[model samples]
Target: MNDNNARRVVSVIVVNEASVLSRITDLFSGRGYNITSLTVAPIPESKYSRLTIVTSGSVRVIEQITKQLHKLIPVLRVYEHEDMVEKEMALIKFPISENLSDINTICEAYNGKIVNVGENVVIAMVSDEPKRIDNFLCAVKRYNPKEIVRSGAVALER
Candidate 1:
């Protein structure tokens, strides 16, 4: 990819209603824009949801996407974050035979803790910035994770 094609984050606020996500995603697909990560959740005590999308494109393409997003009927607002706080969560599972003390130490480094321990597995939960989360995943490779699930990025503009 060209250096001009940089990763960008866009946050969209929309009405909390059926088919809203479908319509929003269709706009990207119809235009052949690829979404690297997407996170959506309803705002508490309100009929609105925030969609956080991560994609790669040139500045021009991002401008176009922002313009198109504003055209959607249910969309309440759309903005590309210039200064924001971003985070992602990851859940990693390891074999029960792994050393608990070592695992806990590693988890603590990433703001993680043992959320569950079972007869056959140990599950850990970690939340941090996307890059830090990536580093955490890399560091935990020595433990041989049995499974891992990571949530998409969620961001708030400053």
Candidate 2:
């Protein structure tokens, strides 16, 4: 990409209705834009859903995406995160043979804890800034994680 193309985070608030996600995604796919990460969740007790999308594009392209999003009937608001707090969550499963104490220490250091202790594995969960989560994942590789699941970036403007 050129210097103008940079990673960006955007949030779309829309009415909680069926097929809304497909329409929004279709706008991206139809335009040939790539969504690097996407997270959708309902606003608590509200009839709205928040769609957080991460993508890479120039300012002009991003502006076009925002304008298109605004045109969608269900979409109420579209925001490009400039000043926001962003986070992500990850769940990691490690072999039971790993040192539980050492693992617990590492998890605690990263604001995580052993959430489950199965017969053959231990599960740990952490929610933090995306970069920190990436660091945590790298640091835990030594423990031989059996499986790992990660959530996409979520953000709220500050």
Off by over 4 Å in 2: none
Q: Write the per-residue lDDT of candidate 1 for residues 33-82, one digit (tens) a residue.
A: 98989999999999999999998898889989999999999999997987
Worst 10 residues of 1 by lDDT: 1-10
Instruction: List the candidates' TM-scores in order.
Output: 0.95, 0.94
Superposed Cα deviation of residue 78, candidate 1 (Å) = 0.8
Q: In candidate 1, residue 65 scores what lDDT?
A: 94
Instruction: Judging by lDDT against the true structure, name the best candidate.
Output: 2
| Alpha-carbon RMSD of each model | 1.6, 1.7
Best prediction by TM-score:
1
Taken over the whole model, the C-alpha lDDT of each candidate is 0.92, 0.92
Model 2 per-residue lDDT tens digits across residues 1-158: 34587888999999999999999999999999899899999999999999999998998899999999999999999999889999888999999999988888888877789999999999999888888988999998999999999899999999
